[model samples]
Target: MTISKDSPDVSVIEDRRLSCGVRLLVESNPSVKSAAISWWVPTGTMDDPDGDDADGLAVLCAGMLERGAGGLDSREFNDGLDRLGVIRNISVHDTSTRLSASLRNEELPSTLELLADMVLDPLMPEDGLDPVRSLCLQSIQGLVDQPPELASIRLNHLALPAPFNRSAYGSSQALESATIEDVRTAWRTRCLPEGSIIALAGGIDFDVAADILERRLSEWSGGSKEMPESRPRIGGDEHVEQSGSQVHVEMAFDAPPLCSSDELPFLVATRILGGGSSSRLFDHVREQQGLCYDVHAGYLRRRSGSLCTIGAGTTPERVSRTIESIYEEIDRFGSGGITQDEFDNVMVGLKTRLMMHGESMAARAAAIAADFHDRGTPRTLSQVAREIDELSHRAVDDLVRSHFNSKWASGVARVAVGPSTPFQPRS
Candidate 1:
């Protein structure tokens, strides 16, 4: 275990790998009276044994973990957490399934016990399985009316490499075929200790948290799992026919993955393009042209790479122009690069955003766990601040210039969900 201190009075960050092969990250913020815990088990969809057939299994298992555990049924378990005034979320992502909770410092010990049992001794009750599965199925069915969400899902499916591209929503066939026994097996096989991360923040002591986890997870031990490499596919345009007055469009272009040299530059670039009302997308498309109510760009990071995604919703009449205008803005921005004034402004904005994010104990805790997954280490606010401070104007501009030459234009993926096919009929 190594320790890193942020300041004399702020928080102390510690990263430790326990004998059980679980990594524990604790950032003790003595100034705050609450604590946040983010636990990641390697039980995400990527680890599904049925491969594509296992899409929704990881998500369903995540939901069932909440139903009961450690001798308590669903109601009793939730009642326990409620009594502690703990706010928690359990969700499945591409990399892993996570249990995140924030509660008062005094409730830390008990909360950890309940959460630990969720991962270690979950009941996976047969009675609860149907409800959880139905919820999962309902969520997938609900997507039909959610064109924007559906468009994003379709875009990710078309753009990202296989397995990574699979939706967390289980396919209908997969969800129906998934028996309770299979979910039990998935949990047992995938919820290993080696590759998991337990991150804690706010009013916590690293040694104390570690002791609690070490005892509770003493019997939890196993090696991690890995997936095979598949051929990279250059994603193209896609359109889904839906009866809607407004067309939802999503476009994705290349960006660097976490731990890459260009990660910071790309972050700055995308932020400048569509991060907020202050960005180019909002300025040129929404406000100036009145093309849509919203037009924004965001950076989506996966372990393999990243995407600078731009989305806008507008009428059928404006859909084509909206898409062309977005690309025009992208081309102009890429061709001209960014001004030093706006670049400097974006730098400050990022620094401020980072500081603000650090204020929330839960957000900070989730970030710590994410850093461990992405970079194999946790970074303090000051460390991240220094990285932001070190970002150069030349670095960002040069990266943007190089991007347009190959990746963004050639492999750009566009998806539109509307009555008309602005993205073509896929013929």
Candidate 2:
């Protein structure tokens, strides 16, 4: 493995590339005593060979990763983590299955080694497969009781393109059809070094952390499976009929990708539309009119593209009007553009948020991993805050003018999960 630093001035951030192709990034903050690891493997729900037929196979594979690894059985594997005082999570996402672990500064070496073992040499025990499969199924089934979450998932399914549109919850059919061998093969083939990222943040030395990973993952190798670029394939208004007292609604429209010039301005505009209690959506839809139990809108994205999302939960009778109100408010915000007052308020809140977020070692760790994947370089909070601080209200308002106008409805998709929702689409 070869290592490099950003520059003498920004020596805190470091980067390393393993000969096998895995990339490692670390941001050292010496004041704190805890370190975090945000590891992203290239395999995820979208990479499942079984597709929807055996959709949850990747997730199942992730669960099996926990059952045992690196010569340790399930029990012993977990015991090792406890001994090192590690707080960890491993789960499947759209483009990458992520593993996050946080431990004391001193525990960094052992914890990272154990985690490396988990990924590089997971036992994937036969006895553990059945239980893991059941848990995956239970999560899918549990979605029935989580209407808002289900609404968002369904919306993503409808608004995005195929293969890439799949949710992390593998369908029951896929889970049942998948065998142990299938799960093992999926991990083996997809768990390659290419496109993988290991990011660490907090009180640690980047050189030392990089050295530990370099040695631990020296043998890991493979090329990244090329990610095909996909265009928007927006679906029409859809609803899921489930017995419930309230309706969960979600609306989505494509936004600029992280790489686009329009990305920053669009991000600012969406926050004004619905970023906090003071946002237009909450202030108008929930506080002023009392239309729903809760309402908010925000931005979300994958590796290449992004979406501007609006979500709400409301009573059955009020569902139609709530949806209509949301649409009108979005249109109004776009048409009228934002005021100087709104722009100033948003900037202050956003800047404050950026500042507060910088305090969390775990958040920083995960963010850099995603950044390396999406932007090809890690960005410091100071860098991000400076960019935001430099933005003029006119720039964001101009984007609002061109992007957030009636055009938002042209490609918009809405989803509702409840006993009853208005079948007819709203303009």
Candidate 3:
């Protein structure tokens, strides 16, 4: 399919499907010399077939794919990408694994072919499994010493249900027992054409890209698998005793899921609450009260569910005070709502970020792939900005009231890592 780049308002985005059912999304930008491609496979840790025992199998499979493919050894495969002057990376998350590359526009065909080989013809060798498994095990072990990460993991496990709660970096016990066959089975069962999206950005011809991908992926085929059902909101509190002078606290609240009508309002509310240096959490908790060394809130977006997470790090002596101050601010924001100045400031910050991301080919490619996976279509900068502008103060206030009020706080999931102390929800 050819997209006309004649009109300034017309987006250069084009979509097509291959014979094998792999979806291809491309955005043509003639102004840039470089192009980026992202191959998004919709299977993640949640799709781990071995249940809790193979927690990190998806991650392990991603690592193994990089080790060898198309009859080439690990070194040979990497060297081939280097020869093309391509920058490559692989990311494994809760719901998907993305293999990405950025290279000169002229190299798009060669790079796509190489990526196809990596996904369709990976040579998951027996000798490669041990090393990958060792690396994964080490990562899991390392998480124990990192208080913040440990606390977050514990909170997710306690708050979320099976598979969704599983970490991308699998458990130590799971990796230790994982074999090459397990990784291969994961690839065969989950990594299929039906649920995959190949997003391309920067200087490229859509017809050529579509043709190259169609011919290369035509022979690849597999059955589509249904994603796991959405789990209920699990809210509770837990504290773990760890020998340390500094304490870590993570609090999570249920929020709107991806592509929901409340998504924009919730995002605006979260930013006003704890987005940056000028946010309420930073100004009140860290600056005014001096209760925490670091405190911030993030909106985690996912297919099945989403969360509004607030975390703080403080000395053991001030841990309880820090927790109280966080809740206090949340209550204050929810009750009084945000001022127009605060809302406008957050909008400016969000717009600046969006503009910056628009300038990079790699960022655009990744964003398009994620949008396609999450919303079934790619969103343009104008569309997103328009949506942000559509959110009024009253709408944002309602969102804050519904999702961050004291009533909501009563059911929050809390995780604290440090010398055990009494930390409970305030009435």
Q: Which run of 10 residues does model 1 get worst, by summed lDDT?
A: 1-10
lDDT of 2 by residue, 232-331 (tens): 5557888899996889888888788877778788888888988888889899999999999888878886664578888888999998888788878878
lDDT of 1 by residue, 1-427 (tens): 1112333324557888888999999999898999999999876766655454657778888988998899999999999999999999988887789999999998999999999988999989998988988888899899988988999988988888776777888787888888999899988988899889999999997788899999999998777677546437458898788886989988888778888888889899888888888899899999999999889988899885688888998999998888778878888888888889879889878767776777889989999999999888888887877678778899999877777433364445888899988865434
Q: Candidates' lDDT values, in order?
A: 0.84, 0.83, 0.84
What range of 10 consecutive residues in model 3 has the weakest lDDT sum?
1-10
Question: What TM-score does each of the candidates earn?
Answer: 0.94, 0.94, 0.94
In model 2, how many backbone clashes occur?
Answer: 1
In candidate 1, the residue pairs with backbone N, CA or C atoms under 3 Å apart (3 or more residues apart, or in different chains) clash, namely: 56-170, 67-74
Candidate 2: segments with Cα more than 4 A from true spot:
1-11, 229-234, 425-427
lDDT at 413 for candidate 1?
84
Better of 1 and 2 by lDDT: 1
TM for candidate 1 is 0.94
Over 1-427, each residue of candidate 3 has an lDDT whose tens digit, in order, gives 1111221344557889888988899989898899999898878888875455658788899999988888998899989999999999998887789999999999999888888989999988899999988887888878768989998988887667656887778877777877888889888778888989999999999999998998999998888778787565456788888887889999888888888899988988888888888999999999998988899998888776688889999998898888778889889988888898988898877777777877889998999998989899998666766676667888887777666776676545888888875475545
